[model samples]
Structures are given as C-alpha cells and as structure tokens.
Target chain A: MKLYNYFRSSASYRVRIALALKGLDYDYLPVHLVKGEQSAAAYASVSTSHLVPTLLDGDAAISQSMAIIEYLDETHPQPALLPADALGRARVRAIAQDIACEIHPLNNLRVLRYLTHDLKLSEDDKNRWYRHWVESGLEAVERQLAAQPGRFCHGDAPTLADCCLVPQIFNAQRFDCRTSHVPNVMRVFEACMALDAFSQTQPSACPDAA
Target chain B: MKLYNYFRSSASYRVRIALALKGLDYDYLPVHLVKGEQSAAAYASVSTSHLVPTLLDGDAAISQSMAIIEYLDETHPQPALLPADALGRARVRAIAQDIACEIHPLNNLRVLRYLTHDLKLSEDDKNRWYRHWVESGLEAVERQLAAQPGRFCHGDAPTLADCCLVPQIFNAQRFDCRTSHVPNVMRVFEACMALDAFSQTQPSACPDAA
Candidate 1:
C-alpha cells in the first residue's frame, strides 16, 4: 500500500492512525500541502481532488480518509475500525462524520487561504475562524460521547470515531482552540495517544514534518 | 422509522432520498433549524449533535446524514447504496464524502450565519463564500465523474454518491453557484431528479417547506 500523505493534514493524519492501528505496512509518499505539491500534475493525476492521504492499494487508489479507512477495515478486518452490529457501526460513523464533516472542512488550509487571501481577513481573524469551528464542533462531539463514555469513542477499543477525533483534536490544539469544554473528547484523546498506533503516527512523527 | 428533519437541510434531504429509494416508510418529523428548533432541549435529547436528519428506528436514533443513509442501506440492502466490490465501494464513498465532507459543511446554515453575524460580513460576501466553495468543489466532483461516466455517479444505478450529489446541486442552485463546468455532476443530478425517489422527496415536496 502507498499513502499520499501530508504530515499536518487532519484527513491524512486520520488514515495514518488507521493504518497504524491495523498494523499494516504502507509506503508513506508525502504530498506537502503547505508547499503546494498536492496541486502538482503528478499528485493531481493520482487524486482527482488533489488532496492528501490518497491510499493506493494494488489497482485502487482511494481518496477520503473515512473511505480509505473503511476500505482498509473491509479488506483487512483484524482490528476493525467500525463496530460489529449495524447500529454500532452507525454510531461510530456518526461520531467520525461529526468531526470530519463539521470541523475539519472549515479549517483546512485551502479554506484558511481563501479567508486570508480572497476574503481579505487578517491572520488573527483567520485564526479566530479556525478556533470558532473547532471549539463548537468538538463541544458537539463531547455531547455525542456523554451518554456512551468509554475507553474510546464507541467502546473499550478504538474505532473510526477515535481515528477522526484524535486528528481533529491535534489540529484543535495546533490552533490553540479551547478544548476544556470537551472533557469526554479530551479523555478519549488521551486514551488514544497512550496506544502506540496513534502515538507513532502523529503529525510530528511523520516523515514530512518540518 | 421517523426522521427528525428540516425541509431545506441538505443533510436531511439526502436521507429522504435514500429512504424513498429503498421504499421505506418513515415519518417526517420536522425540526425547524432556522427557528432554532434543533438546538432546543427536546431535540438535543434525541440528537447529541443537535443537527437535523436524525433517524429514529425502534430504540436507535442515528445522526449524520451519510451514516443514516448507510444504516438504512445496510439494514434494508435491496437496492444497495454501496457497490459490491471493495474498490467500487471505496470509489462511491469517496465521491459521497467529496460532497458531504467538503462542499456541504462550508455552506451550512450555522457557518453562513456566523459569517454574517459573528464575522460581520455582508450578505453578498457571504454568498461569495458560499459560491466559492460550491463551484470549486463541484468542479472536483466533475473531474471525478469524468473518468466513470455512467448513468449515475458510480454506475448505471444510483448509489450514495447520487443521493449526496443531487441535494448538494439543489443547494448550489439555490445559492446560484456556477454549474456549467460540472456537466457530469449536473447530468447525474438531472438523471437522479427524474427518478421518483429523488423527485418526490425533494425540499419543495417536504411537509415543512415553509
């Protein structure tokens, strides 16, 4: 497997964690988003969206971190990313999407560039924009986990929800967002980091980390 | 099944189309997002994220439109929302997430309202924000579909990609985003809208359209 990855990208970080959790070995081919390498012709040919963490498994090159994680889980089902039952799977997916859909999209590099360059917002305002979405979004995730507080986002074991949460929290902390409100989320983040899978695949540990 | 839905919510609209496609009977319980009904205590009790399109089936309440749609498809499994092959499923999911995670989240009502009220941007600026994401995002989807020009997003049948795309295009048109570049997406949207499942469950046809 070959993963087109960026060290700091939340989406790329997600797939990295998933691969580590599954104990799968993959080639880490970095596409530096900050350096605009993702927009280059070679990377563009591989990923139509020109996004990082595009996993190439044999004939298939998959984009979207959640989809790639699901693909890995389906193909190699040792430590499943999703739960066994349909309802459990739905809950895990919901939590994952809660962060992936709501928080990460708005604060991505492209969006921030648009805010500063296109919308003409100040750097401080852009940082504020970043924090605003992350704080509110994670608070919602905190509520989602309030009823089912466990070692991970779903149960005792880590699932897709945890994969997404850890990366978003990593990004949240990078932006100096207020995460005190999301105690449950923080607890889960701490638990996830204790495991070698998450700790080893973090942004700082990545080959592309500056 | 009961869907805690809002008429114009793009997320809610995706589930409605999925339910209709499966010939499933679900009560449309409206949660007026514009009226701040989703944030109310009662709705929050049911939906932790306080988002519209929370699907309640028996004792389980599923949030996240993509998750709900997947749950419905998994439990029903007649007209499959995902493909049979792992690679194909990955492709379909990538396309769905292309819209769900990237395009829809940025243009969500909360984000737009934040742009106007909190960020103090003018309405025209807000619309530009909306159009910028939509146009660029749809063009990416167009490139995705260009390689595989079937009747639908994946193949001849309507998968989850079509379910997500149609609603997104509906919202894009509502905001007057440029659509001429994304002919494949528009073509798929037109093909999808012609179907009874997509046509009958649209925003205009919903009970809470006002």
Candidate 2:
C-alpha cells in the first residue's frame, strides 16, 4: 500500500494514525498542499478530488480519509477501528463526523487562504476564524465525551473517534485554539497521544513536516 | 425512529433519502435551522454538536447524517446503502465524502452566515464562495463518476453516494452554481431524482419546507 498524503493535513494525520494502529506497512508518498502539488495532473489520477491521504492498495486507490480508514478496517479486521455492534459503531462514527465534518473542514489551509486572500481578511481575522470552529467544535466533542466517559473516545480501546479526535486536537494546539473548556476532550487527547500509533505518526513525525 | 432535522438541510435530506430507500418509516421532527432552533437547550441535549439530522432510535440519539444513515443501514440489511465488497464500499463512501466533507460543509447555513455576518462579505461575495466550492467540488465528483460509469453514482442501485449527490445538486441549483460543467454528475442527479426515495424526501417535498 502507498499512502499519498501531506504532513500537516488533519485528514492525512487521521489515515496515518489508523494505519499505525492496525500495524500496517505502507510507503508514504507526500503531496505538498502548500506548494500546490495536489493540483498537478499526476496527483489528480491518484485522487480525483485532489485531496490528501489517498490510499493506493494494489490497483485500487481510495480517497477520503474516513472512507480510507473504513476500508483499512474492513480489510484488516483485527483491532477494529469501529465497534463490534451497530449502535456502538453509530456512536463512534457520530463522534468522528463531529470533528471531520464540523471542525476540520472550516480550518483547512485552502479555506484559510480563501479567507485571507479572496475575502481580504487580515492574518488576525484568519486565525480568529480558525480558532472559532476548533473551540466551539471541541466543546461539542467534550459534551459527547462527558456522556460516554471512557479512557478513549468510545471505550477502553481507541476507535475511529480517537483516530479523528487526536488529529483535530493536534491542529487545535497548532493554531492555539482555546482548549480549557473541553477538559474531557483534552483528557482523551492526552490518552490518545500517549499511544505509539498517535505519537509516532503525528504531523511533525511525518517525512514532509516543515 | 424520530429524525430531528431541518428541511432544505443537505445533511438532513441525505438521511431522509436513506430512510426512504430502505422503506423504513421515521417521524420527521423538524428542527428549523433558520429559526435558531438547533441552538436551543432542548436540541443541545439531543445533539451535542447542535447540528441537524440527528436520528433518535429508542434511547440512542445518533448525530451526523452519515452516521445515522450507516446506523440505519446496519440495522436494516436489505437494500443496503453500501456495496457488498470492501473496495466497492470504499468507492461509494469516497464519492459520498467528496460531497459531504468537501462541498456540503462549506455551503451549509452556519458557514455561510459566518461568511456574510462575521467576515461581512457582500451577498455576491458570499454566493461566490458558495459556488466556488460547489462547482469545483462537483467537477471532482464528475471525474470520479466518469471513471466508474454506472446507472447511478455507483452501479444501477442508489447507494450512499446518490443519497448525498441528489441533495447537493438541489442546493447547487438553489444557489445557481455552474451545473453545466459536470454533465456526469447532473446525469446521476437526474437518475437519482427519478427514484421515489430521492424525489419524495427532497427538501421541497418535506413537511417543513418553506
């Protein structure tokens, strides 16, 4: 398997964490988003969406980090990323989507560029936009965690939610988003970071990290 | 099952189509997003993220439309939303996320509000932001669909991708995004809209739709 991804992309970070958790080996093919390498014609064949963290398994190429993660879990069943039961899977997926859909999309590099360049927002305003989504989105995750009350996002084991939470928290801290209010979320982040899968595959640990 | 959702919400409409496709009955408990009902204390208890398209099944309150749809699919196996094979499922999910994560999140109400209200962009600038994501995002979907030509987004059956695609197309048309660029996507949209599951559960057909 060859994973085409960027170092700092939260979505790429997610697939990295999932791969590490499953103890899978893959060649890391870095696509630099800042340099606009993702827009090149060569990268477009790998990913129609021109997004990072596309997993190429033999002849098959899977885009979308969540879908890639799910594909990994489905193919490699042991140490499941989702829960065994349907309801449990729903809870974990809900939490994952809470971050993947609600927060990270708004604060991604392209959106920030659009804010600063197209909309003519100042650097301060751009940072403010970044912080706004992260802070409020984490608060919601905090509420969900408080309700569940586990060592990880779902249970004793780190599931898909943890895979998503850890990366978003990393991005949050990178932008200096307010984390004080969401103690439960922060606690989970700490627990996740303690794991080798998360710590070793984080953005900075990637080959292309600036 | 009771679905606490808003009419015209792409996420909500996605779940509605999923339920309708499965031939399952769900109570449509409308949460008017435009009326600020999603931010209420009552809603916060139901959805930690305070987002629409939260499905309440017995005691379990599942948030996130993708999660809800997956949960529904899990419990009701016939007329499955995902493909039988792992690789096939990955393809369907990638198409779904191409819209859900990439396009729909940007054009959603709160983000648009943040653009016009917080960033103070003119109406035209806000619409430009909306069209930019939709047009570009749909073009990506078009490329994916062209690669995997079928009667629907996946095969002859309307999988999760079609559920996501139809609502997004509705929103694109509502906002007058450039639909002509993506003929394959529009072709699938036409194919999906022909189905009762897609047409009957659409935004305009909903009880709360204005």
Candidate 3:
C-alpha cells in the first residue's frame, strides 16, 4: 500500500492513525499541499480532488480521509474502527464529520488563503476565522459526546471518531485556537495522544515533517 | 422516524433521498433555515450543529446527512447505500465526501452570510464566491465520476454517492452555477430525478417550498 500524505494534514494524520491501529504497513508518499504539488498532473492522476491522504492499495485508489479510513476498516475488519451496530457507527461518523465537514473545511489552507489574499482579511482576522469555526464545531461535538462519551468519544475503546478527533485537536492547538473552553474535547484528546499509535503519527514525527 | 428538514437545504435533500431509497417512512418536519428555525432550541436539541436534516429515530438522534444516511443503510440493510465491496464503498464514499466536506462547507449559508454581512462583499462578489466554489467543486466531482460512473454514481442502483450528487447539482442549478460542462453529472442527475424518490423530494415539490 502507498499512502500519499502531508505531515501536518489532519486528514492524512487520520489515515496514518487508522493504519497504525490496524497494524497495516504502508509506504508513505508525501504530497506537499503548500507548494502546489497536489495540483500537478502526476498527483492529480492519483488524487482527483488534489488533496492529501490519497491511499492506493494496489488498484484501489481512495481519497477523503473519512472514506479512506472507513475503507481500511472494511477491508481489514480487525480492531474495527466502527462499532458493531448501526447507532454506534452513526455516532462515530457524526463526530468525524463534525470536524471533517464543518470545522476543518472553513479553516483549510485554501480557505485561509482566500480570506487573506482575495477577501483582504488580515492575519489576525484569518486567525479569528479559524478559531470561530473550531470553537463552534467542537462545541457541537462536545454536546454530542455529552451523553455517550467515556474514555473515548464513544465508549472505552477508540473508534473512528477518536481517529478524527485526535488529529483535529492537534491542528487546533497548532493554530492556537480556543482549547481552554473545550475541556471535554481536551480531556479525550489528551487520552488519545497518550496512545502510541496516535503519538507515533503526530505531524512533527512524520518522515516528511518539515 | 422524524426528519427535521428545510425544503431547499441541499443537506436535508440528501437525507430525504436516502430515506426514500431505503423505503423507510419518515415524517418530514419542516425546519425553515431562512426563518432561523434551525437555531431555535427545539430543533437544536436534536441538532447540536444547529443545521437542518436531523434524523430522530426512536431514541437514536443522528446529525450530518452522510452519517444519517449510513445509519439508515446499516439498519435497513437491503438497499444498501454503500457498494457491496470495500474498494467499491471507498469509491462511493470518496465521491460523497468530495462534495460534503470539501465543497459544501465553503458554500454553506454561514460562510455566505459572513462574506456578505461581516466583510461586506458586494452581492455580485457574493455570487462569485458561491459560483467559484460550486464550479470547482462540481468539476472535481466530475473528475471523480469520470472513470467508474454508471447509470448512477456507482452502478445502476442509486447508491449514497447519487444521493449526495443530486442535491448538490440541484443547488448548483438554483444558484446558476456552471452546468453545461459536466455531461456525465447532468445525465446522472436526470436519471435520479426520473425516480419517484428524487422527483417527489425536490425543492419545488416540497410542502415548505416557497
């Protein structure tokens, strides 16, 4: 398996954690997002969306972190990322999408660049933009977990939601986003970070870490 | 089952299509997005994100259209929203997330409102902001579908990918985003609309549609 990734990409970080948890080995192929390498024809051939964390398992090429991670779970079917039931899977996917679809998209590198260059928002304003979405998105996540959260986002064992949450908290701290307010998230994040799987795949520790 | 929906919400529309495909009966409780009903405490209880398309099934409340749809699929199990195989499921999920996570967030109501009211982008500029993301997102979606697209996004049956693609195309056309380019998408959109499921749930046909 060949994993096309960027060290700091929370999306790529997700796939890496899933791989580690499943104990599957894959060669890391970095595609730097900041340098416009993802837009090149060679990379575009593999990743149609020109995004990082494209996984190729022989002929099965996949993009979108949640999708890739879900695919990995489906194929491997050991140490399952999703719980056995429907409601459990929904809870996990909901938590994952709350970050992937809501928080991360608004503060993505491209969106921030647009805010600064095209919309003429200042750096401080851009940071505010980042913090605003993160705070709100995580607030919703906290509410969702308020009922079901245990040691992990769902129960004691880590599920797919935890895989996504760990990386997001990593990025949130990187941007100096408002973490002090989200204690539930902070607690769970620390728990996941304590795990060897998550800690080993931390952005700074990646082979292509800048 | 009860679905908190807005007549024209693209996200809600996706869930509605999935419900219809799964042949599950649901009470379509209209929550007016434009009227700020989603933000109301009643709706927000079920939807922490304060977004439309919250599915309340018995004790299980699900948010996020993709998550909700998958839950429905898991419970129903006959007309599976996902493809049968792992690689096939990955392709479908990648197609869905390419729209849900990547494109939809950038063009969502909050972002548009922020662009216009907060930063004071001109109406034309706001339209440009809407069109810019829509065009590029659809183009990327087109590329994702170019290789394996059949009668629907995956096969002859309408999988989860088609459920997502139809609503997005509907919104793109509503906003007058570029459409003459992606012939494959238009064909699939037409194919989906021919069914009672897609046709009946359309914005114009919905009860709250005004």
**Number of the top candidate by DockQ?**
1
Q: Under the 3 Å rule for N, CA and C atoms, how many clashes does model 2 have?
A: 0
| Native contacts kept, each candidate | 0.88, 0.81, 0.81
Candidate 1, B1-210: lDDT as tens digits: 999999899899999999999999988899988899999999988999989889999998999999998999899999999999999999999999999999999999999998998888999899999999999999889999998799999999999999999999989999988999899999999999999999999999999997
| DockQ of candidate 2 relative to the true structure | 0.87
Q: What is the C-alpha RMSD of each candidate to the true structure, in Å?
A: 0.8, 0.9, 1.2
TM-score of every candidate: 0.99, 0.99, 0.97
- Checking candidate 1 for backbone clashes, the offending pairs are none
The best candidate in terms of lDDT: 1
10 residues in a row with least lDDT, candidate 2 chain A: A44-53
Stretch of 10 with least lDDT, candidate 3 chain A? A140-149
Tens digit per residue, CA lDDT, model 3, A1-210 = 999999988999999999999999999999888998999999988888988889999987899999999988888989999989888889899999988998898887887887788767888878877888888889988888776669988888888899999988987888887877777888898889889889999899999887
Q: Interface root mean square deviation for model 1, in Å? A: 0.6
By TM-score, how accurate is candidate 3?
Answer: 0.97
Lowest summed lDDT window (length 10), candidate 1 chain B: B115-124
- Tens-digit lDDT track of model 3 for B1-210: 999898988999999898888788988899988889999988877777788888999977899999999988888987888988888898899999988998898888888887777677888888887888888888888887778779998888998899999989988988999988888888989999999989888889888989
Arrange candidates by TM-score, descending: 1, 2, 3
Place model 1 in a CAPRI quality band. high
Better of 2 and 3 by TM-score: 2
